[model samples]
Structures are given as structure tokens and as C-alpha cells.
Target chain A: MLAKRIVPCLDIKDGKTVKGINFVNFRDAGDPVELGAQYSREGADELVYLDITASHEGRKTFTELVKKVAANISIPFTVGGGINELKDVDRLLSAGADKVSINSAALRNPKLIEDIAKNFGSQVCVVAIDANYENNDWICYLNGGRIPTEKHLFQWAAEAESLGAGEILFTSMTHDGVKDGYANEALATLAENLHIPIIASGGAGKMEHFRDTFTLGKADAALAASVFHFGEIGIRDLKHYLREEGINVRL
Target chain B: MDVAIVKYNAGNIYSVNYALKRLGIEATITADPELLNKADKVIFPGVGEAETTMNYLKEQKLDVIIKNLKQPVLGICLGMQLMCRYSEEGDVNCLGIFDTDVKRFIPQKHEDKVPHMGWNTITQVKDGLFNAELENQFVYFVHSYYVPVNEFTAATTEYIHPFSASLHKDNFYATQFHPEKSGSVGEIILNNFLKL
Candidate 1:
């Protein structure tokens, strides 16, 4: 009876939401706490706040913002980026993040995922794989998609699941910022191969993209950034569209 | 006025506190037995492994304290699973308050996934756990193990199959889903639990 989740990814820079064209060139979005509350009110199933530049001093500020957003919003939200140690996970979860997503750190040390899953339940830790279709196949990338790994996307996703990631956020670099559609083919492969939930990230242009991802990609959730932030799609209306398209969304 | 959340290395108890805060109620997270005993309502909220957490609770003697709590006690997710007679997780026995057994979810088909995560509707709600206006509303859930339908089952949800989504007996209530994360549907449930 689980409905497909619609998530809005807010890139946080100094506690404010920012929109990065593709993976760079940041533009001011708005206050994260305000946007998060609005998304929850507008029927966003979940939210992810990714700290873009996670410095030592600014980490505290983002943590405080997460606390504020968590208090203001009733729906669950997760915090990620620059989480390198167990203490960071503890701090974010303590500050009221429902879950913590690890990207570059997990790529560096898969055991980080293992340790987190061992300590906190696997349900709390999410492994986000930033990947791109390159050289005839999908290749995984790390460090904000700057460094490409030889690791195959499907193989690494399976490894992450074994390493205790409760969910996998698969963001396709090629599809990101293009406003075309989601990487439905790769997403479908991940969904079919993995037993855990697959959160399809990047490449969400219009309302139909979300519908296609759930139907064609078979993703458990579809995530977008600019589409939601730039007023291109209101979450309430998107859910209304999805519902009309025979998608079971909470309206 | 004194609502205490029993904390024992569990995950996401802060959201529950935050939910109560939105309702204009401030809850204290504590492991102190005396504080829990004195509170008007005690919420046993958790998101952690059962056996390891059970060991921690035993080490702190919170097992006996929780079983003996006279106030309206509500357990969430792992807290609810641990309240059962036994759990398949880590092959461990649990606090025997509900007299039901918790089983690990095994996907029946290739499409059916474990860790039945995301929003699902809870039907057949009873025992004041759910507001009447919130009948069959979708609530957020993220757990792998579930308590089967039993005499104490108050609400049920279907995923891989129909299972106990909520349980109630006497003054004790519990849920397999996270009300703190279920948006307005969850807020209503928490409000009703407080009213109870």
C-alpha cells in the first residue's frame, strides 16, 4: 500500500537553500527552513537537505537549520554532505534529521556504511550514488560527481545494499540539469536488481517525468531540485497530476 | 503536563519530541526510571536493533521499569517490536507486554521488497490510537520487522501482506509506523494519543 514518494532536494550553503545548475554555479533559492515547511505542507513525502560546502564552522549553522526545519515540518527530512564520521551521523540524527545520506564518504570507505548500519539501524543511513552514463555503460562518481570511479553503477548499488544502506539515492549526472527526464533505464535496472528502495534523483523536468519514473523506472521515490524551487512545479499540483494519471499519491 | 520519552540509544526520538513541541507540549527524553514513573504519559520511541537495544535496556534495568509503567505508554517502531513477547531479529526474546510475536518481513514476490518503507494506509484502527476523522489515512513507515495480527492488534496495513500496523491493550499502545514523520496524518494520531 506504499505510495511512491516525492522528494525535494534542497542544496544548503550556509544554511540557505541553493540551486546548482547541474552540479555547479550556485544560485540562491531561499531559506531552507521556510521552503521545507512549505514542501511538507504542499504534500512532499520527504525532504533532503544536502550541505554543499560543509566546512567546520558552517556545519554547526546547517545543523541548527536542520533543527529548525525538523521542528517546523511534520514530514520526515534527511541531512547529508560532509558526513565523514560516526559523530557527524550522531550529531545530525540528534539534531532531529530522520535519516542521514552519505555520498563521497561511503565511496571512500564502504565500511563507513557498514559501521553506521551496525550502530544505528540500516534504516537511518542512506547511500547516495552520483553516477553518469559513460564509455558505453553507467559509471559511478564521487566527491560531488567530480571524480569518476571505475566502479559500475549497478555493482556498487548492490554493494551498498549489502554494506547496510537502507536506501539508495541514485542521481544520474547526465540527466541532471537537462530538464529532459529521469534516467529511467538505469533506475529500472537498480530497482529490479536491488531489494531495497531506490530513490531516483536528478533529471526531473515536468510532472510527467515523475510519473514516468514511478511507472517506467519503477522507482520508490523521485527527487528534484530546480523544478520545485523555481516555481516550475508546485508540489500540491504535481501530486494532483500524478493522482489523475492513476498514480496513488496522498492528496 | 509531564510527558517523558524513554531514551536508550534509539534513533529519531527527537522527531517525536519535535511533534509534541508543535502541539505546544515539551517532552523530556530520559532514561531515569523515577522521572518516567512520575510523568503523566511515557512514550517508548525507538529506531534501532532489538537485541542490542534490549541488552542495553536490561543493563540499565529499564526493561522492568517499562513493563511496570502505570501511565499510558506508547511504543513506536522498534519500541513496539521490542514490546512483543519475542522477535525474530537477532533471535532474541522481548518484553512480554503485548503477548505477540514479531517476524521479519520476507518478500513474497520479486517485486515485494523488504524494509517495507514509505507511506501506507492504516485501517481498522481502534482503542483511541487513531482519530475518527483520520480513518484509513496514510502514515510514514520504515521498518523490516512487523508484529502479526493478534488479539492486541488495533490497526492493520497491507504491504507484502496484511499485518498489524498498530497494537493496543490496557493502557499500552504501539505502532509499526512513525507518526512523528507521517505529516498531518501522524500529528492527528499523536494528538489523539495525548488525548487518551
Candidate 2:
């Protein structure tokens, strides 16, 4: 039986770990390298590094950082946020990223998904869809939820799948930062419709949230930020909790 | 001993090389028949469509070269599928190193996802790539096509159903999962393979 995955996402800005992630016992949580290695040791199935650095010069150093992190950790890792074209993906992949998650770039040009998949294989391409519920419908947003798009989340996910996305990382803007629970309804719907793996993102604050996302949401993986980052929930403890809950998690 | 990773239109080769580097072993990534044949250990790895990769292998004469290698050869993911007798991935024939067929997993339950990507436990572990210590430890996997359980299966994992998590046939070895990315457990598997 394949164990459900637990992923910790680190948001990076200007080559530094942002979001004030403070692991009191771990001294170097602020450094991405130390943080990534720590999470891998704590039994995190995978890690996602989202580079939010806004400068062009900062982009060059970020690729180097990806390579450094990839060299340190052995588990599967995904890089997202600034990937805009095939060249960007190539740099990240060459720099040791197992997969590249494309969001706004894919929304801007759907062909980018097909192009990256064609060149690097779908296994290396991930489609991250940021969706928000508006007017009784789940609408997709672009540019980090700053810009809204008419595209529906369901339709975009399916389209991305058809365009050769190996996996879908669906992050609900509405559920994000709420820390109540995941968007189980939308997540389940996507899981029901998509053939590829659906990684549920957003609203994971507690151990039960992860359990619900796996059972009710039917998600293949549950990804979160603050819970693991702030030391509010330890991955080793969470895996133990999920195991006791009868959910098959990597322990 | 020199190890050569057969690099031919594949993926995860870099990761494999890095894993070996972690163990203080440097491996050469090459498709040249002479190098592959002469190496102490050879690894076949890829992440792509089987048909296109098979065609590329044939064009480069690697299809013949890989099949004839006498050294201990290990294949991962698509690399493992290509070494099988045939694959349903692109409805093409493979290297026939293992006596098994690769078939696409049809979801028995709605939760049975394709490309069974994540960490999973391996049971019935053999002593080849997987040692006794790693008998029931988890390994990372990402593939749509699975090699069904058969005589060559070294270990088995249940996704849609029990499938070949790792395979062994004399000097030839294969794993459906990525041992390079599987953390300490994966490192042990690779380390065991190197020891062989």
C-alpha cells in the first residue's frame, strides 16, 4: 500500500526563508538548506520550495539555492513560484529539483504546460492551481491570488492534466490561512475527476485536517506551511497520529 | 570498481549519480556500449514515454546494447519497464530482462490514483537491492505503468493491487520506485546494489 504523503512548503523571498518560520529547538530554521534537511529528517515525505523573490538578480542565486538544497536532501523536492518558461524549468531541473510547479505562467500560457511536459516529461511538470470561491463557484486566480480569472478550477485542472501535467497541486485561496480545514468538497471533486495524483494544499492546521483531506477529500498528498514551519505540529508526531488514526502515512 | 549509469533519453540519472556520490562512489553517465559493458555496475534510468524512449534506444543501438550487457544492471521506473518483456505504456516491446509485462493500472477504487506517486512500504524484500534492515521500509515511487508480481519480483507493493516494487533476475535488477530519492532507506537499497 502506498502511504499518503505529507509535504512541508517553504516560501522563499530574496534567497531567504520568509514567513518567520521559527523552529525553537532547531537553530537554522531561517536558512532554507537547514530547514529542508530538518524536515526530511522529521519524516516529511516531500518538500516544496516556492521562490517569491521579486528581483531578476535574485533569480540567479535562487537556482543555485535549489541545487544546494537538492544536494542536501534525498527525498523528492518541488520548486515553484518563478518558473515562467522552459528555460526556467531547465535551470531548476538541472539544479536538482525533481519537479517544477507552474502556476501563473501556465495560466498565462497553457501551452507552456505542454511544452515543458514534452521536453522534460510530465513527471517533472506540476500544475499548481490557485483557486478561490466567488459567487458560488470555484474560480481560478493568477499572479499569486492578486489577479482573478474567469477560468473555473475544475476546468483548469482537467486542462492542465490533458496538457501533460503529472500532478495537480490545488491550493484554495479561501481555505488558505484559515487553518480550519481543507477544501474537501473541491479537493474530492478534483480527485474524482482527475486521473493523475491530486495534492491537497491549504487549510491544514491540525492532525485531523490531514486525516480528513486523505479520507474525505481522497487526496493523495496533503501539503501545508505554518503547521510544520512554526513548530505548531511536528511531522514525526503527525505521522504517528495519522498512523494511530488508521490512515496510512509514511512513518 | 567503476560504475556506469546508462544514460539514454532518460530521467533521474542525475539523482542516481548524486546518490552514488553520497556513498563516495563516482559513476559515469554514458550510453556507449563499450563503457556500459565494461563497467563494474550499470544503472538504466529514465522518466519518459516508453514508445518514444524505446525508439530512441533503438536508433542509438542502445536497445541491443542494454539487452546484451553481462554486468549487473539495475533499472529504475521507465528504466525498469523498458527491461521488461513488453509494456502497455506505449504498446511496445521491451528488453525482456525480466519475465513480466507492464500494464497501466486501472483504478479499482476511485482513490486508486494513476502514477502512484509517494512513499510506500515494500514487503517480501529480497537480499539483492533491498537488505534485511530495509525489509518493510518505505520507498518513493512515481509511475503510471506497473510491473505485475511475477517470478522475477524481488519485492511487492500494493497500490491498485500488489505490483512489483523491485525485481531481480540473476545479474539484472530493477525497481519501480526511485531508490535515489527514497532517503536513508533508498540509500541503503542503492548501497546494497553497489555491494552486489
Candidate 3:
């Protein structure tokens, strides 16, 4: 059986790990390479490094961080944020990152998805969508949910799958920092509509949230930041809990 | 041992090199025939489409060198697929090192996702690359196409159905999963192969 993954996302700014609540008011976590290595030792299924930095030098620093992460951590990891073109993807992958996740750039140019899949194979492309629940409809957002787009969640996810995205990492801004639970209703719908795997992001407080996401949302994986960063949740303990709850997880 | 990673026109070879580095072995990555032939063991790693990679291998004469190698060779992911007799991916012929054919996974239900991404357990392990410690251990896999369980299957994994997780025939061994990226268990598997 394919185990449900527990991912610890490390949001990078100026080459340091930081976690923000609802995409604002960031707090320093620790060094990315060290944090990532700790997570790996604790039996984290995978790791995600989201580079939130905007400067060109920051981008260069992020690549160096990626190299260090790949060399130190044995588990597979994905690198995202500020990936606008094919060259960016190449740079990260060449640095030994297992996969590359694209968010805003993929939305602005849907063709980017196809080009990545064609050149590097679909397994290498992970399309991350950030959205908010408004007006009884899930509206897509860009720039870390600061700007809204006309695209709806379900339709855009279907389009991304058709456009050759190997996986969809959907983060609901409405429940991001609530620490209540995941947007299971919308997530289950997306899982049903797309053939590729769905990674549920945001709103993960307890082990039950992961269980609910896997059972109700049908998510193949669950990603969280602050909870895992602040020692609020231990990955090994979480996996043991999930396994006891009948959710398949790598122990 | 002089370990050399066969480098053709393929992706994701760097991770394999890094994995070996973690084991304290600085394996050489080269497309040169001389280096490959001279190595004690050769690792043919890839992550790309079948037909295109096969074409590139032929153009660079890597296909012939790989087929004629006498040392132990391990193929991973697409490299494993290319070792088969044929692949449905690009509707092309492969190196025929293993008497099997690769087929794209068809989703049987809503949950049977393609690319079988993430960690999955492998069973029925019996080969030089696998030991008692590896039985039923989870490994990382991310691919759309798979080789069906057959005579050469050294291990099996169940997703939509039981498929070949690893194949062993004589000195050639191949795994559908990326052992290098599979964490600690992956480290053990690579160590086993290196010791062989």
C-alpha cells in the first residue's frame, strides 16, 4: 500500500527557515538544513522547502540551501517559490532537489506546466495552488494569497492536471493558520476530479487533522509548517498516531 | 570498488550520485565508454521518457556499451524500464536486459493514482540487493509506467495490483523505486548493492 505522507514544510526567507500565520507575521524557525535533517531523523515521509524570498541574491542563496539540504537529508524533498521559468526548475533539480513545485508562475502561464512535463517528465512537476473560500466559491490567489484571480479552485485544479501537473498541492488560505483542520470538502472534490495525487496543505493542528484529510479529503499527503516547526507535533509520534488510527504511514 | 554512474541524456542522476556520496563513496558520473567499462560496478540511472532516452542512448552508443557490460549494473526508474524488452511509454523497444515489457499504470478506481508517488512497502524480497532487513520495508517510487510481475521479479509491491518492485537476472538488477531518495531504508538497499 502507498503510505500517506507527512511533510514538514520549511518556508525560506533570506536562507533561514520561517513560518508565518495566514501568510503574514513570520517567525524564525531555524536553519533549513538542520531543521530538515532533524525532520528526516524523526521519520518525516518527505520535506518541502518554499522559498519566499524575492531578491535575486536571495534566490541564489536558496539554491545553495537546496544543495545543502540534498546533501544532508536522505529523504526526498521538493523546492518551490520564485520558480518562473524552465531554467529555475533546472537549477533546483540540478542542485539535487527531487521535485520542483510551481505556484504563481504556473498560474500566470499555464504553458509552463506542459513545458516542464515535456522536458523533465510529469513526475518532476508539482503544481501548488493557493486559494481562499469566498462567496461560497473557492477563488484562486497568487503572491501568497495577497492577490485574487478569477479562477475557481476545482476548475483550475482540473486544468492543471490536464496541463500535465503530476501533483496538486492545494493550500486553503481561509484555514491556513486556524489550526482547526484542512479544507476537506474542497479537497475531496479536487481528489475526485483529478487523476493525479493531491497534497493537502494548511490547517493542520493535530494528528486527527491528518487522519481526516486522508480519509475524508482523500489526500495522498499532508503538509504543515508551524505545527511541526515549533515542536508542537513530533513527526514520529504523529506517524505512530496515524498508524494506530488506521491511516497508513511510514514509521 | 570503482563505481561509475552511466550518464546519458537523462534526468535525476545527481540524486543517485549524492546517495553514493552519503555512503562515503565518490562515484564517477561519465558518459565515456572507457570509464564505464573500467569501473567495478555501473549504475544506469534515469528519469525521462522511454523512446526519447532510448534514441539518445543509441545516438551516443551508450545502448551498445550498456548491453555488453560484464560488471554488475543496476537500473533505476526509467533506467529500469529501458532495461526491459519493450515499453508502452513511447511504443519503443528497450535494451532487452530483462525479459519483460513496461506498461503505463491505469487507474482502476478514484484512489488508484498514477505515478504511484510516495513510500510503499516491498515484499517477496530475495536477491543480492535485498536482505531480511529489507522485507516489507517502504521505499520511494514516482513513475507512471511499471513492469508487471514476472520470472525475473526479485520483489513485489501492491498498488492497484501487485507489480514488480525490483527485478534481478544474473548480474543485472533494477528497481522501480528511487532507493537513493527513500531515506534510511534506501541507504541499506544501496549498501547491499554496493557490497555485492
TM-score of chain B of each: 0.98, 0.97, 0.98
DockQ for every model, please.
0.84, 0.71, 0.87
Taking the tens digit of each residue's C-alpha lDDT, what string does model 2 give over B54-134?
999999999899888888889998999999999997899988888789999888876676768888899999878877777
Q: Per DockQ, what order, best first?
A: 3, 1, 2
Give candidates' CA RMSD values in order: 1.3, 3.0, 0.9
Best by DockQ: 3
Q: Comparing candidate 1 with candidate 3, which one achieves the higher lDDT?
A: 3
After superposition, candidate 3 runs with Cα above 4 Å error: none
Q: If both were scored by DockQ, which would come out higher, candidate 1 or candidate 3?
A: 3
Name the weakest run of 10 consecutive residues (lDDT summed) in model 1 chain B: B127-136
* Model 3 steric clash total: 0
Error of 2 at A242 (Å): 0.8
Error of 1 at B29 (Å): 2.3
Candidate 2's error at A78, in angstroms? 0.9
Query: Which residue pairs show collisions in model 2?
Result: B11-B46
Query: Looking at candidate 3, what is the lDDT of residue B10?
Result: 74
